[model samples]
Target: MNGPNDWFQQNQDRYRREQYERQQAYLRQPQRPTGPPVRQRRAGRRGPSPLVVFVFSAVGLLVGEAVNWFKDVGPVFSSVCTVVAGLIPLLLDYWKSVAEEPAPGRGRAGAPSYDRGGTAAGRVLGVLVFIVVAGAAAYGISWGVGYVTGNETVRAERLVSPVAGRADSMTITVEGVGVTDHYTKVRISAVSRAPTAVDVGVGHDCQLVDDGGQTLQPSTVANDQTLLVPANGVTVRAVITFTGRPAPTATTLTLDFSWFLAHDFGFGAHSLQVHEIKLKADPA
Candidate 1:
């Protein structure tokens, strides 16, 4: 009779043979398609393309220019409007991005990966648009601030100049101030005992001094070739102006000038002290 070990070995060999036969039978049978055809996942659509964003921004810029022309808007106003217009589209795109749905072929897990702009191109274009708008807005704000400040300073109350210095045979009087296309023009009168008409060189430019010890600059650019040639007379009157854009506005501005009676005569540099005359611009 066979012992326990002999019997165990025989049983194990029979089991192995059965398993191999079963596996071969399975392999020979027609195999069904694996795991129900991988469910085809669709990729959803993307957001606005980069080209679209770029085009929209360009159009916005053109529209802004047109509006400025039609409305005669200031530079600051035009720039501000353009910035606002350009940003509207960008804002919309951002909102869409924040609410983007899952794309086809991409699962719910991919939703979080949705970019602000649908496509890479779109995102890049959107960024460029934002940059342009931001720059324009900043520029507008700066320009507006400067303009308002400058106007206020030039429109303040005026202060009269100190009494004309006592000098030899010279009388400098502050006639008045008037508004011209260029600026608040200053008028001054001077009577000098000179033989011929004096060459009164207004000297390139002038400045307005206020009683509060504030110095005023001209509102307009200084005319490098500006000169005032007084008529031949004992009493000479001339029109002059100063740079006021940078100067403070006041009810009265002290007109300070070196009264050059007769630069043509032998008087040479021998002259009186600087003449200060208070000036007030005519009512607007």
Candidate 2:
């Protein structure tokens, strides 16, 4: 048997020989000729530049604004004009590209050039056009709806009787204008000191009397009657009566309207009563 050192020496020598032989074979192979390095072409054909798309879109928006300002054109018309103007240039560019390209089944161009039609730039333009048109339509619809459903015209008036020794009366009238198919209801209330009292009566019977011998009738009150006022212009009235004992005092009356209709109005009789009277001794 060989000793351990002799066996190790022999194996090392065999491995070195195998490595040298592989290196020699690699070196003997023919060297590849290095010609001028081919440069990589940049992606995308030299079609209509992005700058063109941007310019066209900007021009379209400007034209739309001009039309809107000069002709008072509504959003629909403005948006239509904008889309048409913007697309016109893009369409022309697409057609030009199509015309320049070789017919189908022809030999491929260098490195499979991309078709300019429906390119990234064109898609971006299409999105912009769609947004403009949709936005304008929505704005116009909202404006029309608001104009139709808004509040109608309303007019209100208050009538107060002259001050008396212990009683006071007041009337309130509310009218509607441009209110179609609606009715009106009016409510009146009286309050006073010096033992004042209220008497609810028909449209013509409402009155106010004081202990100082002063009196007021319905004729003295304004908006005390109800009539079928037209929807175009109609008015409703309320009448209240107040009577009381003698005292040097002033009274305050309040009038309110509720549940008003155009053709037939309804509201409950309302009144406010107080027993304390504050009198203005002298009129300025």
**lDDT for each residue of candidate 1 in 1-284, tens digit (9 for 90 to 100):** 99999999999999999999999999999765544234332354344555665566556556655554344344555455556655666678667655653456555432323333246686678667776765575456534533542211123323355345334545566655544322454556776555654544454434666555666544443332333334344665654545442233344445554445455564653334344444444344
> What is the C-alpha lDDT profile of model 2 across 119-169, one tens digit per residue?
578778766765665446544543343234221111222213232122223
lDDT (0 to 1) per candidate? 0.51, 0.40
RMSD in angstroms, candidate 1?
13.0
Show the lowest summed lDDT stretch of 10 residues, model 2. 176-185
Tell me the deviation in Å of residue 237 in model 1. 2.7
